[model samples]
Target: MSTNERLRRRIPQQDRSRAMVERIIAAGHTVLLENGYEGASTNRIARTAGISPGSVYQYFPDKDAIVAEVVDRWTDALHARISCVFAEALDGPADQLSVRVVMGELLDALGENPRLLRVLIEELPRSPDSRLAAFERRMDDLLTVWLRFHLRGHDAPPVGAIAWMLVRTVENVAISYVLDRPPVERDIVADELTAMVTAYLRDISLP
Candidate 1:
């Protein structure tokens, strides 16, 4: 009957709701990957997840909500991967190779999840607020913090500007690869792009 006990009692319900949300998101992802954007439907996703269609509705009012959560999950995972790669460089000196290393890691990670990325790109415009806008904001915030953290001793480009440029550049590269329109070999393309950007920054940041 105590207040604290009542609050503790709600924790399990919240946890269960979160778990259901995750399951629905996962189901939506699989459906999207298999069916592409137009083919994916709430009923199919629910069937794929072994849940009733109404149950999915309980967690998500519509398919767009599911798509948003799927995109958010993908973004979180991508950030975690990049964060682990950058954590070592964040505390110490910055170097061209470190930049290359981060870029390479991002390219590699995206390569591994190309299908999911494709689904994301396809679903972006469909989002109510549009995933592209949200993604742009998230990428800028994360990259600015990480870049400023690492570019300690270096007189680097303005963190916010560089963050936007980096996100835009990498996103274009990723999209090209996703669409099979990359100008050259995808593996070498990211490295070359990183090298170009690194050299430019080094030149501009020079005293």
Candidate 2:
């Protein structure tokens, strides 16, 4: 069966069942945080959720499925927060101030859950069809639109390429700041990133 089909098969349809599934996902997050991916088990997740192992199996086929659901929810939330930042940027000129706002918001959002962020970046296995990859693609499209509007009539690299670079650069640096616990202050990191991105955009916009 297709991946989507497998996912659909795992989702509970009834209200009570759905709540149980959510509980399991929450427990999965806790266990994954406490135990790391290799150490997390369905029994541990079930214990954390205050449910039996069979209950966990009722909602999810295996430990990996529960972890996927947890990651999916986390990515969806992070995607929404970052997407809103970009959406707001579309209304204003993509100036240095706008770039600063975007960078600041990104750092804040990613820093909100540093432990989970560390687990995601350092522990989880990534695949092409993973939720994280999907989140990146969505951000790329949003950024491409924003860049195209601001770079109109300017000699620049392909907007898609610029958007891809910007997304990856900002994501990596922000994740690093959150996970690495660098001695530099948060605002300083945001300021540097903002300056770097703003300068790059300006250079590209030049004829």
Candidate 3:
């Protein structure tokens, strides 16, 4: 249930073993979304995986163990996608970066696995601890580094504080927008967020 569990987690070494693990994870994802957490059991996952219930337990201690692996895989991919955007956007003059450019990359990241994201948002928190925590921490780590140097000695609010706000605000908007019905086009939302960020980065006076 806790993130630490993943550190010593079991992994399939042989190709056949790896394939079985993948199948089990895929089944877990499907069952978790379809049946909800309460209904997702090792036995059900094994049935969906075309494997035996003992086989499921051979790999994962319990259902949460399976869910933990699923979240780990997803969060790793999402982190890579977002980090790529940050590298490109922050490589040049950070000031030249528009909200459109930043937001587009971020939206693209969210576009990768909306369903898994929904599961993380809706279900994972029920556990005492979650892999989603790692994902959020990774975002904070990457964004904090970017913010500290992006402005290059320019005057601004505390890098830590504003970076926290930036990540939280953008995450809420991105996730909510994806889950909401018929929200405005991503570009318009990006523009609005860009405007807000630009203004907030300035002194008390706004022109």
Taken over the whole model, the C-alpha lDDT of each candidate is: 0.70, 0.86, 0.73
Q: Candidate 3: count the clashes.
A: 0
User: Which one wins by lDDT: 1 or 3?
Assistant: 3
Residue-wise C-alpha lDDT for candidate 3, range 76-122, written one tens digit per residue: 77777776776676565434255558777777777666776777787
Q: Candidate 1 clash total?
A: 0
List residue ranges in candidate 1 displaced over 4 A: 1-22, 90-94, 126-159, 181-187
lDDT by residue (1-207, candidate 2, tens digit) is: 766655552668899999998899899999999999998999999999999999988877788888888888888998898889878876787688888888999999899988888888888888898888998999899889878887888765699988898899999999999999999999999999989988897788887
lDDT of 1 at 14: 83
Give the lDDT of residue 6 in candidate 1.
26
* Model 1 residue 76 CA deviation in Å: 0.9
Candidate 3 segments exceeding 4 Å error: 1-9, 95-98, 126-131, 150-156, 203-207
Residue-by-residue lDDT tens digits, candidate 1, 1-207 = 542332131112587787876788899989888887778888999998898999887767667667666777777777677767766544444466776776777777777777778877755464434445565666677667866765677766688988788778876776667567556766587677778767765665555
TM-score of 1: 0.72
